[model samples]
Target: MVRGLTVLCWAVATPGLLWAAVRLLGVERGPLVQLLAFTPYVAGWSLLPVALSLALRRWWPAGVAAVAAVALIAVVAPRAFGGGSPAGGGGPTLRVLTANLLAGAGDAPTLVRLVRERQVDVLAVQEFTPEAAARLDASGLAELMPHRRLNPVAGTEGSGLYSRFPLTATGVRENPGGFTQAYGTLTAPGAAPATVESVHPAAPYSLGQLRAWERDLDAQPRATPGGPIRILAGDFNATLDHAPLRRLIASGYRDAADATGAGLAGTWGPYLPDQRHSSDRVPAIRRMAARITGDRIPPVTIDHVLVDRRVGVRDVSVLRLPGSDHRPVYAELALPRAELGG
Candidate 1:
């Protein structure tokens, strides 16, 4: 009985310990890349191993499980309570909204409505399609956000950046993952120029795409502290828990969601992986049905608004967009004054 109890305790406890190590040491690879997206959920479950080991009087496993639980919690807890930067009272405020259109299947009218109602100053879209672009413009997005740099194409390869302010030095760059990202220098009146991009690094949808995913994230442009403010917003396809994303954020940028303590909120997939980006054509009823049944599958935070560390993050919220698998992340940021040259 003691041997059986030891086996049971070790079974659960060992996996938690492994998860904690890989997460902290940034050693995740292949399928683990995809799996680590659920680290927040795993963090909560880590406690179970500790309890089991302790209750079974398995002293060795108990110590190990306790360490794992503490480590995982330490990794996840801060995101729930980070020090939010104060809004720059008199500085220019840029309200950013980012979403993945799921290959243009996200509702055009609803996306437009979000921009209008939220008074969004900049909008970054991923998985953008030419058809979706036309639909959005026709639905009055062009009027709301007149300035734009769009790379709308067929399928999920497109991205776009739309702003109310003028855009300069705009272009679309294709990442190693074959996704085109739209970028531009946004010059809002009375504020410093911001180089913003609609970022969509490759998702590690399969083990085959894992390397591509890492390369894409590694290639993201870093912010220079004394340079023009940079904001990278869209479906990053990575969460704060992922190592590559964390490394990129460490490079002079702060995730608006993390800065505002909304980091743990899920933005993608309460849907199955296969259904997460399915066509937007599925009727509203069916979509709701999937979500209701998918309550057991916890979503992950992959969409983000990463601003220059110097920028102030006033607020962050994850909002529902009915037709898309991903939720839109809206962040209100205060850009530094023009005098503070980079």
Candidate 2:
């Protein structure tokens, strides 16, 4: 009977331990498995083996407990070391819009219409191609957004900024080809000079890329323009679940949507196996719905608009936009009266 109980515990514990080990060793992929690095799931998995050993009054439980504790520690160590800031604080009011154009999936007109309707103050676009830029220009975007910045000219990881206020192109890098990872000055009519950083870190195909991007964001220089507000916006390609992202939170950047309880706005690959695809001529719309509903696996939030603590964000939302694999994130930031000098 004792042997049987021990076998039962081993049966449950071994697989959990192996899975945890694999993730820790970087043997697995995807955002879901990454959580084993810090989530509480590891503790529950390690407990059964410990209980079995304790029942027999053996030294094995100690071993089990030590291993389990280590796994838990690896997953949560970043946070313990002060990796993220408080939920939401600091910064003046700044409205923001972020979207990935998906290299012109034939939804430009609709997307332009949405931006005009929403009256988005600052717009950031990734994967923006020159053709899309032409389309946007034809749509009179230049009139609405007088100031603009473009990087990578027109391709993947390419970024651009369009704002109602005039943009002073400072700190432009030519090899990353004039893509100012840091750009934009606020021209919101008597508001402070806010600096906006538009970043699209290199996606992690391997552990190295992932780690580099993490450090890049963590160490990304901060620019203060005599303004109480700072804004960071773009396709991080990383989620809140990761260790590096926690550090961004620690740095006092406010995640607008989560702060306002806007729900998990996952912007990535769309289409579930069970999902029925529409025959509509526009693939962008069909795909956008697939992304929201998570027709395949669960949705993940990759794109984001993070604001500084002094800014009070009233609302944040996901909007369906044409010509992109990802939807646009819109946020309404409320400026403090003192910051506004009102």
- Highest TM-score model number: 1
Residues 1-342 of candidate 1: C-alpha lDDT, one tens digit per residue: 879999998999999999999999998988898889999989999999888888888999999999999999998988899776944435788899998987788888888999999999999999898888999999999999999999998778999999999999999989999998999998677788999999998888888899999999999998888777889998889988789998998898898888878999999876433345544554455466576766666788999999888888988999978667789999988988787636
lDDT of 2 by residue, 237-332 (tens): 666555566567667666776667553556654523222322232245445565676644444566777776655677777877644556678887
Best by lDDT: 1
TM-score of 1: 0.92
RMSD of each candidate?
3.3, 6.9
TM-score of every prediction relative to native = 0.92, 0.67
Per-model lDDT: 0.87, 0.60
Query: Which stretches of model 2 miss by more than 4 angstroms?
Result: 1-93, 104-106, 169-182, 222-228, 271-295, 337-342
